[model samples]
Every structure is written in C-alpha cells, then in structure tokens.
Target chain A: MNRFLKILFFALLVKPMVLLGLGLNVFFKAKLPKQGPAIVVANHNSHLDTLVLMSLYPLSQIHKIRPVAAADYFLKNKLLAWFSLNIIGIIPMQRKHIRDTSALFAQCHRALDDGDILLLFPEGSRGKPEQLSDLKRGVHHLIKSRKTLKVVPVMMHGLGKALPKGEMIFVPFNCDVVVGDAIPFNADAKCYIDSVSNALNQLLALCMTRQSVVKDDLE
Target chain B: MFNIPIHSFYMMTFVVILLITGSLIRWRLQVKNPQTDYLELKQRIQSWWWMIGILFGILLAPTTVSIIFFALLSFLALKEFFSIMPTRQADRRILLWAYLAIPLQYYWVATNWYGMFLIFIPIYVFLFLPMRAVFIGETKGFIRSLGTIHWAVMLSVLCVSHIAYLLQLPVKNEQAGALGLVLFLIFITQFNDVCQYIWGKTLGKHKIIPKVSPKKTWEGFIGGVITVTLISGFVAPYLTPLTMVQGFVAGTLIAISGFVGDVVISSVKRDLAIKDSGTLIPGHGGLLDRIDSLIYTAPLFFHFLYYLHY
Candidate 1:
C-alpha cells in the first residue's frame, strides 16, 4: 500500500512536472525504443538530452532505464547529487580512472543482467552538433561482456542546436531521435564490439546528414 | 453569503465584455498575419476556456476544495522551477527534502500558523538542510549544493506559501474570511495577465524590458493595472471588508507584483536555456508559464492583506 501510494504520489507530483519540463514529448508524433535490457546509445550534447530520452519512454519505464551520467558532474555538487540520483535515477560513472571504468562496466553488466535497460551516451561527455566524440571503451566493453543485451543505436538530432553546450538559453526548435535497428552480437567478443561501434557511427552519420527544418528554411 | 445574484451578474457581464473585445481584436489581427491566424485563434479559445473554468470553480467549489486546488497549482509551479535548474547527483537527497517541503508549508497555511510558514524555508529548512549534508561529511560540492537547495526552497515553497497564507485571513463573516481573499487575489492577478497580453498585442510599442521580456510593454502594464484596479474596486466590498480605493490599491499592487514575478521566472528560464518550464498545460508553455505572475504576486499580496488586517 505504501509503495502504491508512493507511485501514485510521484505520478501526481513529479511526472506532471517532468512532462511539463520535457514539453509533452509523448504527445509528439514520434517513435520510441521497443523493449528493455537494451543499450540506448545517443550523442550527448546538453543537460536537456537526458530529459529528451526520459520523455520518450513511458513514465513507468523511467526507473527501468538508468541514465549513465558522469560521476564527477552529478556528484560534484550536493543539491544536484540528490536530484540526479533520487529524482532522475541516474547511474554515475567515473570519467578519468581506468579502475573506475572497470567497476562501472561491472555495474552496467549487472544492471543488464538484471533485465534493466541502460541509457548510454557513447561520446562519454557532451559535445558539439553532429560531432561524434571518440567512442569511450565503456559502450564497447558493455556490448562485448553482455551476450544477451542488444545495442540500439539512437541518433538525437537538433538537441545540440536547441540547447547548445555552455549555454542556458534554448531556441525554440523541433528535435527528433531515430532509434535504428539493433546491432547483432556474435560469439567473437572483439568482432561484436567493432560491429557495435560501426553501427553507432552509421547512426550518427544519419543524424548529421538529415536535413533540419530550421536550417532548410533559413537557407 | 453576500449577494450571490449581483456577483454572478457582474461576473457574467465582465466575461462577455472581455470575450467580445478579445474576439474582435483577434479577428482584426488575423487579417494582418494570415500564417499565425490559427495559432492566435487557438490561444484565444484556450484562454477563454481557462477563464470560464476559473470563474465557475470560484462560484461552485467549497473554500477547502478551492484552497487545495491553489495549493496544487503552487506545487506544479514549484516543480517546474526545480526541473530547469541544474542539480548534481549528490543533491538528490536535498531535492527529496525540497519536494517534501511543499505539503508541510501548505499545511502550516491551512492550520493558520503564519509565524511558522513565514520562516520555515529561510530559517529552519536552511539550517537543517546543511546540517543534514554535514552529517554525511561529503563536503566536496557542499556550498554549491546548499545554495541550490536554499534557492529552490526559497523560490518554490516559501515564496508560494503566500497564496496559501491568504487562506488564513479573518473577514467579517466566516466563509468570506480566508477563501474569499485567495479568490480575490487570484482573480485580480490572472485577469491582469490576460488584460496585459491583450493590451500589449493591441497598442504595445514601448517595450517594458525588451531584453528580459520582449512581449511585456508599458502600454500593456498600464492597461492591465487599470482594468484589474477597476474590477477589484467594484468587487472588493462584496468579497471582503475593503473599500473601493483600497481594492484599487490592492489590484495595482497585484498587477505590478505579477509583472515582476513573470519577469523573474522568464530570467530563470533564460538562465536554464529552457523555453517553457514544462508542458503540462496545453496552450500554456509549462507550469511556470501558468504561475509565473503568481510567484511574486502571492507573497506581496499576502503581506499587503496581512498588514491591512483583513
């Protein structure tokens, strides 16, 4: 009963607020990722990127998808630390150390093993529009290690332009995420990792190549 | 109850006048900007629908129900405020505390504990939150964490409780005391927003604060204040124990404060690089869009009534 009340409370209180923050993304005529235990890899651009992803999924599925955020950023401040963990359910990963990366991979593997979907941004950090930052070994490792999990390459277009890096002012624009076909996993672990990386690059290329409405109108 | 028949008649007349004038102006403008005609028409329809709902709700709903509705409004508004503001993972515990503060603050207002409501966020919550963080002994981003928590509570909870505090006012009659005041404040503030938007679109050339809020104009501000003041001046005696001049003064204050509230929230949105605080309300951008004017107006209007002994 207590758990139900808590869920109801969140539905009434937090969900409405989040939907408002995300601009009723569910209402938009767009597609979403199909199922769980899937790795959703997209380009990282701004803080709003997480919100965009969260908005795409149903409210009940929010807990099922753990956003892999930088531990340094989310854990850096006390207030943000609480919001990221409790409110948003972000999984923090250390960016710098190799040992930290291994531990983070284990946690990801465990989460996937437990049938939870992982929201991973392969760029590892926020970057410019259409530019794919060097693929962090995290995504490669997670794919190679987990035999059951499918790597769904998602390309988030127009988010970077909407809310640019190091800027807090958002220009009114439409953004869409394209969830491509899942990368097939094989017995050869190294080959599987390479295939996933290539799939992600192709997805990013599709995003970069797609003509934006605003850009076309301007020209 | 005060003369219900007369109040209903007055409200009906007010709504009719606003609807006719707004429709006429919107039709005239539609010819000039054919592309934006549908969007403008939709906005007008939505605003009218909201106005009707609010008017009917005030007339029909009990005081307690109305108060709860307003409290819910404040909750959504505050939630929007925090969503845009950046927070780190370590701050999740503090956000949990922030979300919990909403009900407690409203409860204090419901129980008429003005003394506690006033200082709950600034004094007690402020001291207790940092102490809780200190207990964890993770002092890395302590100062930044504490500041965000403090700011969020101050803006969302402490500031918004002023609307709740309106529910505690003592009037000549029991029913007219608290709930009536809340209704009066809301009516004046929201009407002022509508009038300002209408007037601004019609005759607004002189920008009030072009950089912060381009849509806000001096013409709109004056028009909103005058319209609200006149309406409040006429309605004050029926709702509360205030004279025409006092009602006008209150209306003027509410209008000005509402403007400030709208601008402050807009500035916050600007800082966060967000358009609308959230998109819960259709036609309205977010919770912030609905209550942007209420944030400053509530606190100022509450204090004003408190000092006036009404």
Candidate 2:
C-alpha cells in the first residue's frame, strides 16, 4: 500500500508539468526523433526546450534523452547541482574550459555506447533567436568518433519569446520543435561536422518558415 | 507505531468518496476538449493522492514523527515563499530568526502551550525581528527589509504553526483532536479548490475578478462554497468540535478565504512575471502552488475552532 501511494504521488506530481510541456508540443505539433542512440542537436533558445523535448517523447525514452547543460550554469549551487544530476540527469559539460574538452567528449561517447540519446546545442551558447550561431566542434567529435550513432537535427522556435535569456518571466506563446531526418555520417572528421551543421541550419530554416505560417493563421 | 482508531477508518472512507465523486465529475467533463480537460482531470487525481498521503501520515504516524513532518513542510513552504519575494542582504539576520522560530513555535504546539504558541510570533518575535535588523546597522532600505521579514515570519511561521497548535487540543479520552482538526481543515480547503474549478468550468458565466484571476467566476465561487458547506455540515460533526451549523459556516469562510489566498499569491506571481511558483510538485506547480490557499485558510480555521472549542 505504501509503495502504491508512493507511485501514485509521483505520477500526480510529474504528470502536470509534463502535460504543460506536452501541451506546448501539441500546439506547435512538435516532431520527435523516432530512434535512440542519436544526437539531438537543437538551437539554444530558452530553458523550456529541454522540457519540451522530454514531453514530446515517452517516459521510457525520457531517461535516454540526456541533455548536455553547461556545468558552470547548472552546477553553480548545491540545490541546482542536485536538480541537474538527480532530477534532470543532465550531462554536465565544461563549456568555458578548453582543458576539460577530452573528458567531456569521453563522457558523451560513454552515453552513446550505453544506448542513450544525447541532446546537444551545437551553438555552444544561447544566441539571438533570428539566426543560428556557428557550430561547435563537440558535435563533430561525437558523430565521427561513433560510427553507429545517428545525428538528428532539431529546431526549437519561439522559446526565446516564451522565456528569453536573463528574463525570469515566461509568457505563453506557440513554440515549435521540428525534428529532421538523421544526417548520415562516416569516419571522416571534417566532413561529418560540416554535414551535421548544414543539416541543422536546414532544419532551423524549416522551423522559422513554420512559425511564420502559424503567425499568418493567427493573424 | 501504529495507533489507528475507528475514526481513522471513517476519515479514509470520507476521502475515498471524495476521490470517486470528484474524479467521476472531472472525467465526465472532458468530452468536448479532451486533451486539455484530460490534463486537468489528471492533475486533480494527483492532488487527491497527495491529500490522502498527508491525511494518512497524520492519522497513523507517531506524534513525534507527524510533528516533524509538519515542521519540514513549514520549512519548505517558508523557504519557497522567501525565495520568490525579493530580500536584501541586510535581512539575513531576520531570516535566521525566521528559521530558528519555526522549531520553537512547533515546540509550543507540541507541548500544548496555547498561550505561548499564540504570542510567540505576534508578541515576542514581532518585537525582536526588527531589533535584529537594527543591530545590523544598515538603515538603507530599512523599512522595506523590516516589512518583508515581518510578513515572512507571520505567514510562514505564525500562520503555519496553527497546524501544530491543533495537535495540542485537549479532548475527552485524549482523542485525536489535533489530528482531526488538521485533517478537517486540509480536506475542506482543498476540496473547495477542486469544487470551485469544477463548478467554474461547467456553469461559469461572469468572471469574479478578471484582472486578478481570469479563471475564477461567480458561479464557481457560489458552487464551491455551497458544496463545501454541505460537506462540512455533515463531516465536521465527526472530525471537528463544531456543531453542524458552525461547521457549515466555517467551511464557507474557508472557501472565501481560500479564494482570496489563491488570488493574492497569483498576484505576486504576476508581479514577478512567472508561472507556477516552482516545479517541485508534479500536477501542482510548486510547494507554494499547493499551499497558496492554505496560507489564509489554516490560520482562519484554527482561530475559529480555538475561540469556540478551546
């Protein structure tokens, strides 16, 4: 009976937050990756994208969606440290430190080998909503190093409007998440990075186009 | 230590009936807009489950254990309250007092010292809180810091300590008066929330205060009050020291006070431009979201019962 109540309590608490995110997905018609052991590369718009992605997938798949957040931002305090490691299970990467590059890449590789989904923002940092930032080399190393892994480009639009950088408030707005087909990769390091970056740009453009169409319909 | 009584069984039955009727009504309403309505219904079910767990803990757990549980909840709720509202570095000493005052207040309740419990915050802490700030010697924004700390101490420490105070009530045969009272307030207050939402969604027409809470409607408010009154009129005889009419009136006051509490917290969130206090609870937004209605209802209900029965 105690176990049953514990499970019931968790369901009640987790479902609403998940549904809020899922509601955003339904409104935007979010497309999620169909397979696992893939790298989900999305534009860094806002904090809501992580939840949007988690809600778009099933609970079984949620555990596999390991969001790679900057260590400095997420691990700054004890409370946030617990939330990131235990609640969200984020993969902490040292964004500012060049010395920790190899260790971070190894961690990503371990996650892939364990059949987990890796969520990476290729831009390395949040940028202006209108344009994509230059792709970071982390994506390049992850894809080329692992031959079996797939690279799926995801574009999250309107999260900047929903909750932007340095803003505490979150306005309810239509945010779109588009998951494109996997970009094929080979062992060639340079080619793999270029191909993934190009695919990500294309997916982002599609998201922008879809957002405009939505705006037209609303108007 | 399990000291489950016959009354515990009665409370369990009451909760079960509430869950069934509430869930059935909520589920039945989702025929039109299935997605959003379904989500809302799911949240209601989850809230009910939490309510049951808390009720069970209060009823079955040992006195020491339950008091600790209430203390922990007060600490968290108080922490969440202060985190959202702006505070100054100068207010640090007052916050230290706030944390220290929680255990001491609950100690008064646990020992059944009604007089000390009542005046601990209003008389003693009230006088000392500002003095602690004065010692800091930072007069810059002094009034604002003092006001914020005083409000926090009142709401988080004084208001919530009433739950502990209920545990101290002396009844014939040393019956579970405190537990019953706590259970009574929690059940009626949260049920008011559920009934109001259900009532508003169905028969709602005119918005009560569209600027403060767009979802609240007069139809829902009336329906919620009537339902809570009817339920309390029947249930209070068993769970509380009040007569039938007194219970009904108490329930009505709870519904009204709960509505104000919900709106007041919503206004604060609006000022901060955030949604859902924090993401601690699943269906509920945060600890604050779950307890927003209780902030006013707990204190009011305690005082009402205290004056009449104690």
Candidate 3:
C-alpha cells in the first residue's frame, strides 16, 4: 500500500504540478543519470527544487531516487517526518553537532550501496532566493572515499521566484534546469569541493543564458 | 452526441487531407534527395499533427471544455511572456493578480458578459496592477516593471481572449455560426503564415525587415498577402458570414495584421535577444512563437466580423 501510494502521489500530483503548473525547460536532459549509485547535486533555492528534480525521472524509478535532506528541518514534527520519509523518501542527514560524522552519512552510503540515486543540495539550505551561497562540505565528505561515485551538477533558475524559502502563495513561473556532465570523485576534499562548485557555476551560467539572450537586459 | 457544426467536419476533413499530402511530400522528398536536412520540416509536421489533434478535441468538446482549453492556452502564453521578459520582485503579487485576471476575463466571455469582457483587462486590471505594485513600496524601476507586466498581460491574455469571445457571439447566419467565424480567423491567419514562409523561401530577394525578422522578404510578404486574400475570399463565404468581396477585405486585413503580429513578436524576441519564446512546442519553438501572428489577427478579425455581421 505504501509503495502504491508513493507511485500514485508522484504520478498524480507531483508530476502534473511540476510539469504543467510550473513549466520546466530541462537542458542537456541526456546528462541526468538513468540509474542509481549517483549523486545529483543542485543549488537549492525553493522547496520546489526537490520535487522538480524528482519529477524529472520516470515514475518506475521513484523508489531508486532519495533526496538527502536536513533531518532537523524535515523531521522536526512527526507528520512532516512521516511524509518526508514515506512519501518523499528523503534520506535525512543530521546537521547539528555530531561526535562521529561518518554515522551521519551511513544511511546515504547504504542507499548508494543499494544503487539508489541520491539528490543533494550542497548549499546546506535554501539561500537568498536565487543567489548561490557557499558550498557545504557535506557532499565532498560523503563522496571523498567513494572514488567511483558519479556526481551530476544541476542548476535551476526562476524556481526561487516561484515559491522561494518562506512565502507559500505559489506563483507560476517558467523554470530552467540545466544538467552538467558527471564530475569525477577527487580524493582531496577541497579540490573535489571546488570542482563541484565550478561545475555548478558553469551550469548556473548556462541556465542564465538560456533564459535571457540579451546580456544587458538582465538586472 | 457531439453537436459539432457541419462546417467543422469539412474543415477537419480538409486538414486531414492537408496533413496526408504534407507527409507524402516529405516522404517523397526524403526518398529523392536522400540527404537533405528535413529535421525542421519533420518537427513542424509532427507538431502540427498534435496541434490539430488538440484543435479537433476542442471543437468536438462542449463549450466549457473549449473555454478551459483556451484559458489554459492564455495561461501558458502569459507564463512564457513572463518567463522571457524580466520582472521585478516587488510585483510578484501583482503578477499573481495578472494571472488571476485570465480566468476572470475568460469567465466573462463564457457568461457572454460583453461589458466586462471588453473592459476588464484594459481598464480594471490595468489600474489595479500598477496600484498593487505601488503597495509593494519598491519604487525602483517602477515604470519598467509596470509597463512590462501590463503589456505582457494585455498581449497574452486580452488579445488572445478575443478568440474565445468569438465563441460567445450569437449566431446570425446559419451557414456559418460563431464557431465558423473562429475557424475562419484561425485558418486564414495560419494559412497566411504558411504561404508567407513558402513564398519567402521560393522567391524572397528583398529583405523586408532584416534586423527584426531576417527570414521575411518583400516578395514573401506581397505573395503571402495575395494568396491569403484570394484563399480567404473562397473560404470565408463558407466559414464566415462575409460575402466574397467582404471576405476579400477581411482577408486583406487579416493578412496584413498577421504579418504585423509576426514582426511585432520578432521585434520583442530581438529585443530580448532570445531565439524562441519557450520550449512548449517541439518543432515550433514555443506556444507564443506559434501564436504570435494569431494574437494580432484574432482581435482584428473578431472586431471586423463583429462590426459587420453582428
């Protein structure tokens, strides 16, 4: 019943809302990994970002995709935790002070081991609207030891204006999602993190150009 | 039982034949040339099939269904308009209101409330949007934001809604009712576009507006106008209440206005420096890109028909 509900939820609600209600123009869609054992990292802006990313995949692959979300925020309340876990299938990560950091990513590592695709927002939290903030090291930490892991960077534009961080009144906006080629895992943490940031920045630049052709027309 | 008019049946049959012929030609061309790039033509035919399929569904469905379909079209167009054109953060709520006005405007047309349909976007929504933006208290780029938002709504919603309003007109002539008029407007406008492209590609020499629309040529413009005018004269008598001469005049107006509409959108795209409006349609670029000519011809044709027949 839970499995049926998940498919039904994504097929009936999430897909239509993301694909139809808020139009998405995905560029380089061929770059999105078809299978699991991959990390799809994107610059987070609106809550819709996760849904948008998940909706990009086929419904049959819903169970194979797990978004790595901050545990405290999504799991603060019982209802949200239940919905996030069962419905969204988010792999909750502990962001607070921790004695052993490896324990925090155990679930993620297991999911990867199981060949499940994990979605990560390396910005830690939804930053100021559309602005990209500093990259969190959690992604680098998660993949530093996993040399063969495939990490894809996706940059989304205009979703922040659609829903943003706090405002609930949903306004329709055309969003552009550009997917970048997979980045090879680096043993050096900073180098890997910089590579991820650079990849994301390039994807973001692609999204910007995709929306506005006239350079000076953009504010 | 679907109460589809007889004329619509004929139009559908004609479209079927047109598509079959188009496909056959593409196949023959491929077989002969074997190496020519037909990707654009292939995409166009595919998109046309889908578009015509949707049109058939709309025509066969009930009044409410058609209204909702056009409403969805307006929403998509307006979304594309906003998606390409820049908008300030302050007018977010105003944009919401701008979207809200679409349904209300269409509702007026559905109810056959002419007073509200004519004035809602131009008068009420126009004044309300700017005032609502003022409440946001960000005076930065005030005129720029207001002008963009207002013009976007007017073009995407107000202008496009005229097509839907054609459905609401009371039938004066049994030969061609409101649906016929709607069909005549759309068919002729699109026919004008196709003819213009063919004429331009075949005999285009003099550039009409090289900066705005590079593909457009004087030969194409004059050739398309003449073809559309002659064709409209023949088709309008069956699809609309206009006689041969009146149809000729209407066709001339639709042909000229369609060109203007096409060029106007070209200028807008040129200003934005974007190639297409949005990626809604596969071969046709975007919904706005496809309907740009219709946006101008719809209202002009509607008012022309209204003033004459009604």
Best by TM-score: 3
Candidate 2's displacement at residue B64, Å, is 2.2
Evaluated at residue B247, the lDDT of candidate 1 is 82
- Residue A218, model 3: lDDT of 34
**DockQ for all models:** 0.06, 0.05, 0.42
Best by lDDT: 3
Instruction: Tell me the tens digit of each residue's lDDT in model 2 across B1-310.
Output: 2554445456767788877887777767776567664775588587767767775766567776777777767776665555455555345456667777888988887787778988998999889988888887877677866777678678777887777667666752224355777778888888899899999999999999998889999999999999998998887877777889989889999999998888988887776565765545667766778888888999899889878876
**Against the true structure, what is each candidate's TM-score?**
0.61, 0.60, 0.95
lDDT per residue as tens, model 3, B141-245: 789888998999999999999999888888765756557877888889999999999999999999999999989999999999999999999888788778899
RMSD of each: 11.2, 10.8, 2.3
Model 3: chain B TM-score relative to the native chain B:
0.96
DockQ of 2: 0.05
Q: Higher DockQ: candidate 2 or 3?
A: 3
Better structure of 2 and 3 per TM-score: 3
Give the per-residue lDDT of model 1 (tens digit) for A1-219. 433553464577555644433333222223345566778776787777777776566656666778898899999999889778777777888777666656767777777777777888877778755355666656766676566667777666555544667765544323445566777768765665566567656654433213322222222
**Cand. 1 Cα-lDDT:** 0.67
Fraction of native contacts (fnat) of each candidate? 0.02, 0.00, 0.35
